[model samples]
Target: MNRYMWIIVALSISPLSAIALSPEEKGLEIAKEMNRRDDGFGDFTATLEMTLKNKQGEESVRVVRNRTLEVPEDGDKSLIIFENPKVVKGTAFLSFTHKVENDDQWLFLPALKRVKRISSSNKSGSFMGSEFAYEDITSQEVEKYSYRWLRDEDYEGKPAYVVELDPVDPKSGYTRQLVWYDQKEYIPLKVDYYDRKNDLLKTLRYEGYRQYAEKHWRADRMTMINHQTGKETLLNWKEYRFKTGLSDSDFNKNSLKRAR
Candidate 1:
């Protein structure tokens, strides 16, 4: 070949080599930081609230009394106690998900006496009459989703990375989601959710990132707005702790009834 042809080939590959990380890789790096924190879960407390709306403009709100036992990488076991007039407060919700497919979930109710099984099929059901579905709260481990790097842009005057995520589970409620990660803190600043019909469903915004440790950051408030219904849900993290001595026994079935 000619010298000009070789020079052209070298220039074509140089630009691609300059960028070291992709968008999906950046998002995964941020998520790992969130999992491993230094100061959260030393017996922490938080208040969670969720709102739901229908096509007819009816809204329902649910309050959650939350306590989390942090076990880094092993999954954080949290007991969500309902505070509304509904029959959920006294009941307990327990979940333990490992790196593999051994995710165990149980619901203990005073009415049932014994813990009732929650099948994977019913994962899309509403939680305590809130807009957030059960699958939304339980979390999707990194293995459950595939990612694509979109691009880099400025968000809130800071450099940010944008990525698209598609769930591996066909039964998942979301169709797809686009996420933006702050380049400095490596925290998610915004997320765009798509519905089952492949249309934009909602937009979530994050604000007030307080650095807990060298690599830990806590977003004080997160708000989600439904594009179709014009309804909104807000989550304020009252507190978050890390490195608590939570054990495997704490996530067992017998311990669920004692979750209060």
Candidate 2:
């Protein structure tokens, strides 16, 4: 009698444990969960030092300040101001990312004294000659790509889920990206970018992750390596401050020109 009751109990729970989601459904679920975890940080400001290195190992450094406002329904807005390296000082880049539309971006060239709009066609171009593309700097909305759960693997001694994402934009420079997202944090620790030709193009590594606001997980350093060019770019982030009461007016194209 005891064995029969145990079998019935096991049968009841078996159905729940055996439930499985399709690959597409599983991928979308993971992406949505990651996005949810990162949401609710109203705004943030940080200082970044960008280091560009050439094939011959020559290095150039530039300092910039970044401010971003979170927009839950769509995407985030950001303003980036070049602060040092007198040649490019006071130059700013403003971006408004959308959930299902092309992102709006503007570049303020202090030398030319003009704020120029960045067309969608140029979104794949290098950002400030760094390895990072203009689109790469924008907030990555879940709607921008179609995802598939690839597999589970160990990355840097951490258990991670491998996800493949294909960009929805026809003109995107990358054909697809494979990301290793840490299971615990749901944040990507490494990303492999492939060119339009379906050739390996670049690899981006996220490092030095630290939690902010006791909930938000942020990487303090990121490195991008261009495989074809043998060039690299490193970004070091510092002084992250959140919820500074930023508004839409602070992210407009006009604000780019006024950015100090």
Candidate 3:
């Protein structure tokens, strides 16, 4: 064919000749889409019951109240207050998550009547002796990790996209994480956490999801199981109130002392 005719043929088949995206690019696209779908929440509050189980099957329960404020340009701010279990009553934790920087965290201990700052190196430590680390409690920003799309598979009978995440922060306790996101909702259904030694450490599963504000999906129950330690933590969330007019001041370090 003549050059002009060949050009015309190529244009006609452009759809089939589209360039394939690299795995990294595809993964980032998925993460961005997930973040986009979850944007504009403004603020929210919820009540949670945390159950901690030891290797010997002993269980301890604690009641907690949570408040979050969304920041459009940066990351979210959150506060967690412990209400039950007299030993831990009046304890509070405040977190300020950033899109590209290490999160700021503090804890208020009623006994000592002091607010202690949590260092970046200690973020990997367990939260109140639970299976979840301090870093795991912060708002997950897309910029916090690099991603790679692994594959599409079925999880709990739902179609899911499997993606691997490598934390951008070197201080992170986990080396990497594998997440299974619901294809339709763009929400994570399960996550496998790999320890710094690159061993499978824990698995987190989200269940009983309920929609709020007709757009936001909140998991009513989350269970984290530690494979090596044979420990488990279960969080049951309730009374989710969205757009409740939470302010930045409510999540500040000073607010930790006032948290009830």
Best by TM-score: 2
Per-model clash counts, in order, read: 5, 0, 0
Residues 53-112, candidate 3: write the lDDT tens digits. 998999999898999999997989889998888778899988888888777878898888
Where model 2 places Cα greater than 4 Å from the true spot, the runs are 1-18, 111-113
Error of 3 at 9 (Å): 17
RMSD of every prediction: 6.3, 5.0, 4.4
For model 2, residues 1-260, the per-residue Cα lDDT tens digits are 69999998778665224457666766777788899899899999999999999999999998999999998798899999998787778989888889878878788988889999877567699887899997788898999889999899999899998999989998889999999999999998999999989999999999999998888888999999999999999999999988889988899877888897
What TM-score against the true fold does each predicted structure earn?
0.76, 0.90, 0.89
Lowest-sum lDDT 10-residue window in model 1: 34-43
* CA-lDDT, candidates in order: 0.67, 0.89, 0.89
Q: What pairs collide in candidate 2?
A: none
Error of 2 at 119 (Å): 1.5
Which is the better candidate, 1 or 3, if ranked by lDDT? 3
- Positional deviation of residue 180's Cα in model 2 after best superposition, in angstroms: 0.3
Candidate 3 global Cα RMSD: 4.4
By TM-score rank, best first, the candidates go 2, 3, 1
Clashes of 3: 0
